[model samples]
Every structure is written in C-alpha cells, then in structure tokens.
Target: MRCLYLWVIIALFLMTTCPSAHADEAVATQSFWAGLSTKAKFQGEVVSNLVGGLASGSVGNALFIGGFSWDSERAGEWHGGKVVINFLAVDTGNPEAYVGDIQGVSNLTTVDSLMRLYRLYYRQRWGQVTERLGLLNANDYFDNAGVACDLLNASFGIVPVLSQNLQGMPTYPFSSLGSMVALGGGDTTLQAGVFGADAVHPWQQPFSQGVLMML
Candidate 1:
C-alpha cells in the first residue's frame, strides 16, 4: 500500500516535470475540439496483489467518461437551469472472480465490459434548494464522505447498510429515473431522493417492469 502511494506521488511528479511527454497530445486534442461545451476525463488503474489474499496477480480497469453541460442562462433556454449528459465506458475484470478475496483488490474491477449512459439529468437551482430529475445515480448525491473515499477499498466508498439492503438505488454503472432534492444552508444540509427499485433493474427493460418508489 505504501508502494502504491509512492507510485502515485512519482506519477504526479512525472506529469508535472515531464511536460514534453504529453504536451503534444494535449495540444492536438485541444485544437481539434476547440469550441465545445464538453469535457472528458480518463481514469484507470491496475491493482496487483502484493500480499495475502486474492492471488499474486493483477487486474486492470479503466473508466473513460465524457460529459457535456449546457447552461440555461448562457444558452438562453431558462434561468437557473442546467442540463448535463454523460457517457461512461468501463473496461474491467474482477480479480475476485478468479481468486476470492474478502474485500476484493480494487474498486475498478467491480464492474466489467459496461458501456452505458451514466447520467443524463437536468437540475434547476432556486434559492437554497436544487432539484434534479432524469436518469441518475444515487451514489452521486447521497451518503458521501470525502476522506473515506481516499482509500482503495470499495467498502469505504459506499454505505454498507444501503448497499446491502437496497435492491436498485440508482448507483454506479447503472441509474434510474429518480428525483433528488437537497435543501439547507452553509453548515447543515438535508438530501432525499426517490428512485425505482426491483430485483433486476430495467436499464435493459427501460421502465417497463419496475416499481418507482425506493426510499
């Protein structure tokens, strides 16, 4: 784990010091997509087993996400409203699939070969409250801890109670037609959302067979 942390520092150092390695690619991409309301991020990692569990091998995963946000005020559509559409492509395989581990090796390998429309939602902000509707993920809005997400364990990222009990609460790699409402001020905030739930989600079925009430 220390090695992984060291590697991260070294990689960041290289990215800052070795600008020549990626300068051309960055310039080319920027020039090609000069005037656009879109941004893309590429994130991936390969986690190799260093000790005890899950075999002495490696599993790799990558997530490439691209999104376009349209501002209602700028686009002259409506005031205080914005629409964002995102696409996520996940290429991954779990190490636990081959050799079982209690906590798994990496969070990236949790889902594999998934190409989906991750989030396509419209949010309207009015005063101190914001309302979001459309295809969305629950993890995007609820039960988030900034520091706990720093670790590599998947268990640390999500709530164990919700993950264990909720059938389909509009989370990662998949989403449902849900509405999220957030209210409050600087120090205190309250968030609540309603989503569709089923034994199997209807991302494939497309709302034909699911109940739209998950508390």
Candidate 2:
C-alpha cells in the first residue's frame, strides 16, 4: 500500500551510459542479443520516520531494473516492428510498521521481495501514429512527469490520483495486457489505452478480470 510510491523515486534518479548508434549498428547483425540495446540501473535510498511513533525508525530499500529493446527495422527490413522487455527487483525493510508513513520510501519497495518481469510489449509505428499490444505499462505512455524525479516523493513519477485510483493500469514493476494508440503533432497529442485492472503479476492469472481504460 504505502510501499508503492518508492519505485517512481528510483525512476527519477536512474543513471545510464551513452554509446554511438553507428557502433551498435556495426555489431547489431552479428548476434541476436547484439541487436538488443540494453540498459541497467541500480538505486538505493532510506527514509526517516520522525515523530510518527515508537516504530518510526529509519528504513531503506534497493532496486534493480534492466531493460532492453529490439528494433525490427534495425534488425533488418522487418519494417516498423519492435520488441521490449524489462525486469525489476526490489528489497525493502518494514519501515511503515515503525513510522506509519503512507507515502513509502522508494516506489519499488514492497512488503514482499521478489524479482519479476516488468514490461514486455510489441509496438509498430507508421509515420506519427503508433500501436502497441501485449503486456504493457500505461505509465510508459501517459501523464509522465519529469519534475517528479527532482523530488523524493513517488507520486511525482506518475500522477498521484491516477496511481491511487486506477485498479490495474499496467505500470512500473508490474504490467498487464493492454494496447495503446498515439496520434500527435509538435505540441498537442492524444493517447489512450485499455489495461487489466488486476494488479497481480502478468504471469499469474493475468486475464481473470475486467479491463480498465486509460484516457
């Protein structure tokens, strides 16, 4: 519950490396994995629970997320097809039990510590329009905030209201089956999608419930 917001904080502080596109092009055709552009990040943080209660002790958490993408156009003449995959892992202490902080420390921290497949989807682009299907995270396409990263609060990663109200709305750490359509110009854009309302892991009973639409 309160442990959910921590993941967004980690996303705000993610670190990465840069490589030449030409360099990757040189090796992309050499191997299957070679064509996949992969990114990995690690994050850690601790939150203090002052004046909350006797259990208001400091707690910490760590996160590991790795993601990779394969461009069908880059792989060959496969046109506008692309595949993406991601993995997220989090470990956290029971700080809420002590401090009763509802906001949580790191968005990724959960009561249970386990690694899971984060996002896996296929997307196709035609000019400015794009279509995506399969396991999806709505947060990847809608209402994203850059300023939220500058602060420690998790609600900054995604809109706090949507994050709290949406039932499934595939998002960070967990994804649900869904699809999205994007049409845009230089300034204004329209994007919408439907995602499973169930927050459970996609690998387990993924389609057992009604779907929720994101507009």
Candidate 3:
C-alpha cells in the first residue's frame, strides 16, 4: 500500500512538473469538475467456512458498486490535458469474499471496495495520428478482455470465455504511465505502454497480474 501511494505521488509530481502550452484557440476551461457514477455488479461465490467440527458454505453472492469521479481539464486548443480521480465502494453480502476483506472470514460479504484514477497527461494531433500520455485507468484496455476481443472480432457474433466472479483486482485509484496513438482518421487506436502495476500489493494481486500481459 505504501508503494502504491508513492507511485501516485510520483505521478502527481510528474503532472505538475511537465510543461504545457495552450493551443491557438480560446475555449472554456475548468480547473476542477466533480461528478458521480453508479454501477451494480453481481458475483457468485462458492467457499468453505471452517467450524469447530465440520464446515458450512453458501453460494449466489452478489456485489454492488457506487463510484465518484473528479476531473480537471486545462484550457487548450483542440487537444487539452486532463486529470481524473475515481473512487469506488462495493457492497458485498460477505466481506470475506474479497482477498483483503475487512473481516478475516473467507465467506460472502460486502466490505470490499475499489478505487482508481484515470489521468490524461497530454494529447497532440499530427495528420491522422493522435497521441496521448499520462496516468490512466487499467480498465481502458484490460477490464473485459473477452469484450475487447469481441470488438476486435466484430465480424463474428461469438462471445468469448468469461469468468462469472472476480476478486483481488487492483483498484488503481492511481496508475502511473500510459500512451496511445490513433490511426486512419480516428478509425483505430493503438496503445503502446503503461506503468504502475509494480506498485500493487498482494491484496491487489489479481488486478496487478493482469497488467503483466499489458506489456
């Protein structure tokens, strides 16, 4: 957790240190903006609860998430820089369902939560290529692998394999580096690299593991 905090601090530092220039056009600029988004998710769990003698268990676990997003955009021309902060608190029937549950039980519970930040460093356009960089959300590319693959394979209507339940995924509340380049007049975008997963802790192992593939 301390390492993650340090990475976030570094990212903030870089954002502040980097030089920025406004475009030749004047437009509305907001130093800060606050908003909220709500999401509901369902998860199923099959676990064993240890007892003095034998054991007990349950299934059909569910989860709910409510998030708050804060964004700030610097005034610029067609391309501008931005920073975003996201926070999420989940309601699981049994907190133990999560790896770092508030409670020690490995049962179904609601104490698990996720937080992340999706920052935009800089954006520039040259002909057909538009490039962007900065701390970003892991979900921008990794959240639903199957869904992304499906989108890339839109010609066929086949749905890919998916896991019904998820746990221990890193809640980046702050990821370090990200860069993307678009091609063919906005028809496609190719992402190059990203950073910050190394700072994730064991509690966030699931999410961090997925980032390894991003490289």
Candidate 4:
C-alpha cells in the first residue's frame, strides 16, 4: 500500500515538530494553569489501480493512521476546558475488516483496518464559542440553517460528511465521520471540534445526521 503512505508522512512530521520543543517548558509552569495536554497524529492514504486488471486485481490500496490527543485543563468546579482523547490506527487491506466482497464478509486485507475516534470531548469556552459535549466518532455536527462547519477543525477543510448505505448510496460515513485532515504548516497545531444531534441513543445515529457543526 505504498509503504503505508510513506509512514503517514513520517508520522505527520513527528507530530508537528515535537510540540515546539516543549513550548518553552510549558510556559514556565505554575500549575501551568491546570496542566495536562497531549496530542499526537499520523495519517496515510493510497489508492491506485487505474481501473483494475491482474487476476485478483489491486495495484493500489494503502493507509496508515495513528492518533492520540488528550487534554485536562482546569479539572474541577464542574470542570472547565480540555479533556479529550482521540485514537486512530487503521490499515486498509481487507483481512476481514477494510471493505470487501461488497457485504459478504471474509477477513479481507489491504487498505486499512478501520478504527477511528474522530473526537472524544469535554471542552468549554461559552463566550466566543467552544462547547463540546462528549462521545464523538462520526458526523461532527452539521446545521446548514445556522451556518456551522466544525468537522474537527482543519481550517474548515477535511472533507467529511457523507453517509448513506442500505442503498441510500453515499456511504463512507462511518469510522467516525471518515476523519482525515491534519496537514497545516509546522510547529504542530491542529485543533478539532464537532457538534451533536443524535439526541443521544440509537447508536448515536451517525452523530445526529449532522447539525451542530462544531460548537
């Protein structure tokens, strides 16, 4: 699979420059304003075959993902901001997971493993906007009438918002809203945000079919 997308671009360039080299020792401590912040990311993608030809066909199909993000700022007084954890480490190849046999199921193997957590939240910023509930893996909110687009920030561009299987068509909506967009500049800095709508149950109904749009 193209060497897992070149090791996810060298693990996103070492998690965006290794945290600015410790950001000056975390700004000289002092309870660091309630410390505890960690982030990690790695991505990969590859798909080539032009059309398909070669016995079992398959000239391209690769993916490598690694993720980790944790926050815990001001952890009291009904909690404040920060307290998230994200995870992703997939390898599409269809060993039985990826996507093969249409729907037959047979432990395929070759594109990606399929495991995402788009965002696990607990943020707070009520003033200029910054509200995160919890349990997020797909559909990072979406409400056209109000004007929202927070599919886990990436400067508002990660290209994810399509779900409709069972004949509906769309597809590619699971795996936590098909997340994949973290390639900015350097010094590492990638924040994420998505809203809610599933009302809560029914397996979160694909994150309420999109409506909140990054609160």
- The best candidate in terms of TM-score: 2
Provide the overall lDDT of each model, using Cα atoms, as 2-decimal numbers.
0.70, 0.73, 0.39, 0.40
lDDT of 1 by residue, 1-215 (tens): 99999999999999887887588678756643443389798877876666766467777788788988777666544567878899888898777754576555555554458777778888998889988988877777677666765336777666656664665656666678778888876878787887666323545565555544433
lDDT of 2 by residue, 94-129 (tens): 666776556654565576777888878899988889
179-199, model 3: which lDDT tens digit per residue? Answer: 555555443555555434432
Off by over 4 Å in 3: 1-82, 93-111, 114-127, 142-177, 180-187, 199-215
TM-score of 2: 0.74
Off by over 4 Å in 1: 1-36, 97-99, 147-151, 198-215
| Candidate 4 C-alpha lDDT tens digits along 1-215 | 89999999999988897797577456545344445556664433332333323223332223333344334444223434565665544455332222223332221122335655545556665444455555554333331211323222222322323221222111122323222222233454244444334422314565546543342
Name the better of 3 and 4 by lDDT: 4
Residue pairs whose backbone atoms clash in candidate 1: 138-170
Look at candidate 3 and tell me the lDDT of residue 25. 19
Which candidate model has the greater TM-score, 1 or 3? Answer: 1
lDDT of 3: 0.39
lDDT over C-alpha atoms for residue 65 of model 1:
81
